[model samples]
Target: MNIALVTGSGGLIGSEAVSFFADKFDLIIGIDNNMRQYFFGPEASTQWNQDRLASDFATYEHHTADIREVSQLEPIFQKYGTDIKLVLHTAAQPSHDWAAREPFTDFGVNAVGTLNMLEMTRLHAPQAVFVFTSTNKVYGDNPNFLPLIETETRWEIDTNHPYYKNGIDEYMSLDHTKHSVFGASKVAADIMVQEYGRYFGMNTGVFRGGCLTGPNHSGAQLHGFLSYLMKCAITGTQYTIFGYKGKQVRDNIHSWDLVNMFWHFYQNPRPGEVYNAGGGRYANCSMLEAMALCEEISGNKMNYQYSETNRSGDHIWYISDLSRFKEHYPTWDWTYDLRSTMTQIHDSMIERLAVTQ
Candidate 1:
């Protein structure tokens, strides 16, 4: 029974990864303060998730503490994580739209919070395989570089580029005007995670992910892209469709696949590697495409209207060039496609929302 610790265990990604590893690990420890709600306020959905996990995962124990406080974190690391074998760090302030309100808060958590985790791991779980979830926003607004053709449903790169055959790759530049405060913090963290592995010889790995959505997500207008859309469509919540023609693109990956990468790398333990984790460009879709699926499934037209004000650090298109991960993790692939995926999330949101709140 390997002991596993996840920092942002209450979040959409963290909860999914926790569910995936619960049966396998001896005892899984989840650390989160649910403080994001303070930022997102009433719109934040994590409280429902925390309540559900407390009920469902009996073997899991959660601690309500901010990672920024070393005193709050050190004891936990000293206990279950003293020699913890795997650390899957899914914690971060992920809203590009919301980051501007407090750049320092975002930096404190995404950047300094990560440094705290790494330093603590160095002290207690030095040999532990550490996995960090980074965002595709690290590449900034890349799809802006491409010539996009808009369809009624979605947007795609021009047919001329050979690599557009797949989508954006790891080679795309991180330096661009599109990066918001969230992107800047994440970029800083992503570089440090890699640097810690290189400089300190830690078993560190980074995942620059596209949209990672699932049923556990506390979907809100600020984050949780797919689940938020599903909630709005099924539950009659209003949503905003920002610029880029609502044709801005994204490739949604299930949380299970993202965790599988961590699970595999944890067991085998990679030394400081970065991979783009997503459903690949093959599963790519635009906001219109996603809402169309939601509308089709729930039989409700989304109560969404387009806005000319493009959100900062928002990408017009940024699909994962997931070939790197696919070639390495041959045993792993997408278990859920767009339609069924949306359906499962919608049904779960209905069931869980009814039961929890």
Candidate 2:
């Protein structure tokens, strides 16, 4: 049977993968232990999304297993054996602040857990295309060192810089920087994913994602920036901005767009290829800009405050350059821009809140 195994199957990207690949794969196996609750708290639990996927897709099989434990993971790999045609590793301890609170858990989940998945795929499903959801944090604070010009609402690269038009790319250095504990762990996993492809000759692809978000995200203050910001706007909760004059910038990509990229890559099968994935010049905004957009969509003023301290290793200006990926996959183009993305998030947040109430 053709099967696809998705770790963190309840997450924004993982859930998207499940739906996107449901028709392509004969069976969709999802392994998640609701570890988002363990990392962020009960409110951040992804059990809701898990249930939704189980109900929505007849082919989906849910497995409550942690990627960190080999015992829990091995049985599934052995069960599927060579039938697993695709393995999407999207589960991660995804917050820098939370990582500082529990370094061991962060490293274990982000680094060692990735190794576990890679090894399992190597042993049982060596032919499967392994796609890892790596973060731009793999570049750490390196992007902050770029020549930037601060405007009233956002920070932009110097107009004269080559990156001004397209934004940062994979050519940027990934060394001698302050990668937070979370980023450090991701770096380990990112390199390992690449190495597995290069050394083992496994069909692996590493995507260094910008702000990955969608309605499905279990939005929390520690992560899922866009989704959480919109939630605060809709709920009238006080949102806090930490440093950079609330002008720090990020490129945002909807989960569908990203997972679609995965589908293209899975079809082509690249080994050890790393791509910088984000909205690029098509969809990017600053904290202040995002707040204004949220208010416009939700018709509620964002209650917000600013703190002088920023998160460790946070980027002041980061817009991904998708030239490499685009050059490779010319057929792929962004379908959701910033406004459309925020609008969808706004509607989704309203529905989710109403359901809970």
Candidate 3:
């Protein structure tokens, strides 16, 4: 039986992977312990998405297991053995603020948990393509050092800077910056994923994602930027804009587009290859711009307040340069732009809220 293993199976990206690859793999094994609840709160629980996955796909097999525990993770890998064709490692303690509250949990989940997955693959399915959804936080606050010009609504790179035309690329240095506890842990895992591929000659790829968002996300104030922003807009929740005069920018990539990129890499099987994944020049926005867009789409005025202190290590302006990934996989292109993505999230949130009410 061909098995595709997805960690964080109930997450925004993981659920997308399960849906996208269900037909390709004979069995989809998902490993998740609903730790989002542990990391954030009861409201951030992903049990809802897990139930949806179980109901929606016949081939999907859900395992409530934490990636940090090797024993719990190994049995599944042993069961599938060589039939495990793909491993999508998306499970993470994904918030910088939350990480400070519990550094051990953050490092254990983000760094050690990744090691467990990598070793399991190496032992049971050496040839399986391992895709890690790493974050641009792996670059830390390095991007903030770029020459930037602040406009009325957003921060823009200086016209003369090399990154101005396409935004930050993989070539940017990953050192000498404040990475936050969350970013630091991700850096450890990111390098390990690369080493597993290059040193051990396994098929592994790291996607340094900017703002990976979709309707499926259990959006919380700590993470899931676009989804949470739209939720606030729809629910009339007071959203706080921290730092950069609320003009900090980020590139947003829909879950479908990112998972499609994974599919391409899985098919081609690149080893130790890294790519900066985001909406690129196609879809990006500042906090102020995103708020306006959400209001326009939801037809509700966003309740927001500005705070002078920005989150530590947050980027002022970050648009991913997809040139490397595009050059490698020319067939892949974005299907959802900013407006479409926000609209979809708005609709999904409305449907979900309606169900609960």
Worst 10 residues of 1 by lDDT: 39-48
lDDT of 2 by residue, 1-357 (tens): 999999999999999999999999999999999989888888788988999999999999999988999999999999889999999999999999999999999999999999999999999999999999999999989999889998999999999999999989998888999999999999999999999999999999999999998888889889889999999999888999999999999999999999999999999988999999999899999999999999999999999989999998999999999999999999999999999999999898889889999
| Distance from true location, Cα of 249 in model 1, Å | 0.8
Put down candidate 1 lDDT per residue, 1-357, tens digits, no spaces.
Answer: 478888889888889877998898887788989876876776674766777778998878888889878899899888865558788888899898778988889999999999999999988888888899998888877657778777677777778975577777787888755788999899999999998899999999999999998777776788888988998897788889988878888888888878888887776666878888887765778888888889998899889888899887687877788787777777877788777778889899788668747
Report the error of model 2 at residue 30, Å.
Answer: 0.4
Alpha-carbon RMSD to native, per candidate: 1.6, 0.7, 0.6
TM-score of 1: 0.95
Error of 1 at 70 (Å): 1.3
Stretches of model 2 off by over 4 angstroms after superposition = none
**Candidate 3 residue-wise lDDT, 1-357, digit = tens:** 788999999999999999999899999999989999988787688999999999999999999998999999989988889999999999999999999999999999999999999999999999999999999999989888888899999999999998888888998888988999999999999999999999999999999999999889999999999999999999999999999999899999999999999999999978999999999999999999999999999999999998999999999999999999999999999999999999999999899999989
Q: Ten residues in a row with the worst lDDT in model 2?
A: 37-46
The TM-scores of all predictions, comma-separated, are 0.95, 0.99, 0.99
* CA lDDT, candidate 2, residue 2: 94
lDDT of each: 0.83, 0.94, 0.94
